[model samples]
Target: MSRRRVKPSLYISVDIEADGPIPGPYSMISLGAAVAGRQDAGGFTPADPEEHTFYRELRPISAEFDEQALAVSGLDRDRLCREGADPAAALSEFTAWVGEVSTGAQPVVCGYPVAFDWMFLYWYLIRFTGGSPFGHSGCMDMKTLYAAKAGLPLRAVAKGTMPRHLLSRRPHTHHALDDAVEQAELFANLMAWEGPGA
Candidate 1:
């Protein structure tokens, strides 16, 4: 008999702290992700009871740590070697874990400043896995979505004062997991006001 597969609806909130803005030339100092499973059709609602989250820290690949980024994140490179997993190993494990969590369901992967995070993650995934399931197609940028749904001007929204304030409220602390959780909270609030359709 064939084994029955579990189809869990999942959403992933991910964040990455890099040595600098550019990829290839730069490196991902760390990464954090929060995965939640949907309990019902409410669709990523705050009230949903069937949600689980996990966090992981990755060791830096290069010694060229950006002083400003490091100061904000407060992650010690020496300590990361002791506490965090290897970069390639961590990415492999994380991708497999996400696949397991998502299983038979199509998961929505979200990030606040997706352009930055996605670029690094995309590069890292393609570098190791040969390709990324998340390519530009599967990612969601909450800031852009919020601006559109709230009917706010792009300039005003981009400032993150009105519709995009949630992204700024938490600030970019540099810790990957903390930032991911912050994005998750912002997403929850946005979903509450705009409803699942938004």
Candidate 2:
């Protein structure tokens, strides 16, 4: 009697720079994603973070934006207003890119405390493209993953609190592509790690 083998989940590390708290009123100024790794029955394969990547800067949706939120990303709003990709077109390209890369695996968005990123990403993909490549709920929170693997309380999970070996060597820059690359390194480390019990 042979059992079927389940395919690994293709962990896609994503980072987004947004202006304001939410999506409708605010907007995602930039987006980035990299194929972090694939973890399955056999084990894990750490992808080259530089390969299989996507990045885009989009024009603001509404006039309303928080100064602080906009300042964090350090992107020139006026420049973007003059030369940014259309939101709908950018998202459409993103969706197609996901499908192309994830031929036989499930694409899972993996980010630190994924909720914030997901909120904007999902909203944009759904609103602009009319559908999300990741669907309605395929987000993996690295913070939560670490908490479970380390057997630590969720509240106790922070980058400073984690074991040095588990964290990414790269610093967290606000640039969406850089952050996504940093997160890809982190995801690869997490996928290859064997916790307390195997």
lDDT of 1 by residue, 88-177 (tens): 777787778777766666666778768888888888887766766555466778777777777776556653464453442565566787
User: What lDDT does model 2 reach?
Assistant: 0.90
Which window of 10 residues has the lowest lDDT sum in candidate 1? Answer: 42-51
Candidate 2 displacement at residue 170 in angstroms: 1.5
Query: Model 2: per-residue lDDT, tens digit, 5-58?
Result: 776688899999988999999989999999998878877899999989999999
List lDDT for all candidates, in order: 0.67, 0.90
TM-score (C-alpha) between model 1 and the true structure: 0.76
Find the candidate with the highest lDDT and give its number: 2
Off by over 4 Å in 2: 1-5, 196-198
After TM-score superposition, the amount by which residue 69's alpha carbon in candidate 1 deviates from its true location, in angstroms, is 2.3
